[model samples]
Target: MEYFTELFFSGLTRGSIYALIALGYTMVYGIIGLINFAHGEIYMIGAFTSFVVATVLSIYGFPLLSIVLLAGLAAAVWSASYGYTVEKIAYRPLRHAPRLSALISAIGMSIFLQNYVLLAQSSEFQPFPELIPDFDFMEPFAHVVGSSDLVILLTTALVMVGLTMLIKFSRIGKAMRATSQDRTMAMLVGIDVNKVISVTFIIGSALAAIGGMLIASHIGQINFFIGFIAGIKAFTAAVLGGIGSIPGAVLGGFVLGLTESFATGYVSSDYEDVFAFTLLVLILIFKPAGLLGREAAEKV
Candidate 1:
């Protein structure tokens, strides 16, 4: 039972991270119908930004709490800027062009960011400071779940709730929904579709930034290539849950995380990727639209 509990929490933590990044992918796709492949690179940038800020603050003898807060803020702001810029430069021009053009541009941007980071920063992994302190209250369950895991789970829950509220009640949320339904119609109805798309990218990038910071802190090290694998998994999670559905993305993330966790625990860790991808394939075969995804008819 203790072992089971440990694996469960581990899976939950991993899922939370995946969900955060996946939200970025899903939101971009929902609004623009274009997959922002560069999103993973945005996440990588966030982790790097947080690492730099936290390291600098630590050197100056700032309090741990202050370091964490400032680092997270910096990561979000910088990542959002990158996301917005990517939208304008790489995607906006191809908005009315063939979907392939936008996809190619996204891929090119991802590659560019990865190589840029590698050249700017060393290719080796850098140690990430332990920003999240172990809480005294969590001592009892420390064996089953670490403080970082607890923090990740709680933080993800809060983020999800806050996101839900924003999309449901806020004016921008309404605009986002309108834009997603039909960009042309949204513009005709006096909604600023471009602004809505930009805002969606910003929110999604911010969320990814948070995930990047938390995961980097949890893992204790980061490299330029970390984003590639994480991004692929998150993208898989989004597709697994229904690419355009917010709730589905969350659900898919948790499910994928648990599957990977249990597979690693009961089986060999070497086959983890195999199992994860196999599950995705099986799910797609049975339900093409996704677990919570509804099929939509194309207008001719």
Candidate 2:
């Protein structure tokens, strides 16, 4: 039972991280119908940005909390800029093009970004310092909630809650919903569809950036190739929960994370990736559009 408890908590922590990143994927796809395959690279870039910021601040004798905050700020800025540029350059030009063409462009952009990171940061893994200090909890059950785990879960939950409120009440959020429902109608209603898309990208990228930082901190290292599988997993979570549903993404992330963790714990760590992928397939077969996803009815 203790071992099961450990796995459950561990899975929740990982799921929280996955959910954070998955939010970005669902948000972008909901708004534009573009997959943004390069989003994972944005995650990678954020982690690297955090790493660099931490290195620089360490020289100045800054505390761990201060350094992490600084890193998050830097990562957010860099990811926002990158997302803006990507939408403007790669996606905007294809806005009116066929879906296949836009998808091809996204793939090309993803490849370009991957190579860019490889050239800039190298392919090797770089170790990172632990941002949160470790301490024993007074309660015996506290072992289930390690410092890093607490941070991941709390940060993700807070961010998710804030995001839900933003989408529910903010002016831009209304515009986004308008655009998602019908771009032409949104434009007629005096909303700048392009601006809405841009804002969506910025928000999604920032979320992914935070996820990257948390993941790197959790694992104790960052690498150029780290985004590949993580991105796929996040995308899967988004799909599992209902790609266009914000709350769905969060639910799916936790589900996938918990499942993967327990599967690895009991089934076999070596086949963890396979198990995750298999689960995705199984979910898709039964739910089609996803657990929370609504099936679109064809118009006559």
Candidate that would win on lDDT: 1
- Summing lDDT over every window of 10 consecutive residues in candidate 2, give the lowest-scoring window: 135-144
Residue 252 displacement (Å), model 1: 0.7
**Model 2 C-alpha lDDT per residue in residues 1-300, reported as the tens digit of each score:** 988989998999889978988888899888888888888888888888888998899889998889989999999899988988999999999999988887888788778888898899888889977876675672565666678888888899899999999999999999998898888999998999999999999998898898899889888998788888888889999999989889989999999998889999999988888888788899899998888887867769
Model 1: per-residue lDDT, tens digit, 46-121? 9999999999999999999999989999999999999999999999989899999999999999999999999999
The runs of at least 3 residues in candidate 1 whose Cα sits more than 4 Å from the true structure, single-residue gaps closed, are none
In lDDT terms, how accurate is model 2?
0.87
Highest TM-score model number:
1
Model 1 collision count: 0
**Number of clashing pairs, model 2?**
0
**lDDT (C-alpha, whole model) for all candidates:** 0.94, 0.87
